[model samples]
Target: MKQAADPAKERYALMEKIQMVDFALVELTLYLDTHPQDTQAIQQFNQLAVESRDLKSAYEQRFGPLRQYGASFSGYPWNWGDSPWPWQL
Candidate 1:
């Protein structure tokens, strides 16, 4: 039998992946600044950009906004206030 997925674990993994990708992108960008003609690095950066976008979208869909004002209000009576801090997760 297939077990159900844990939302908390899934979210944690997603966030961790996004951060790692973003960090890689930053490092690649710095390298490209010095080696502007590095096609391989440029291609990798493009791929990471697309991936980061998708991950952010998925995260926003499951959780609330990545930013406080990123999207329309969710939940009844302003649940954002009651929710745990983003860093807590």
Candidate 2:
């Protein structure tokens, strides 16, 4: 029989991927600021942005909002408190 996946581990892994993609996006933003004519970098940045957004949405649907103060939507009963906080992960 196959074993079940661990929720905490899965959550942590997804969060790590989002962080990596977001970090790359930020770096690309800074680079593009200097090299505005680089078409390849621009394309890469756009791709990463979409990937980051999708990852965050998937994570939020499974766990909770990755941000607060209207940055992310919370489910009924306020699920922000339902999952482990970033620091706790």
Query: Pick by TM-score: which candidate is best?
Result: 2
Candidate 1 residue-wise lDDT, 1-89, digit = tens:
99999988998898888889989999999999999999999999999999988887787678765656745445555556645555676
Clashing pairs in 1: none
Ten contiguous residues with the weakest lDDT in model 1:
70-79
In model 2, residue pairs whose N, Cα or C atoms come closer than 3 Å (at least 3 residues apart or on different chains), thus clashing, are: none
Off by over 4 Å in 1: 68-82
What are the per-model C-alpha RMSD values against the true structure? Answer: 2.7, 1.3
Error of 1 at 6 (Å): 1.1
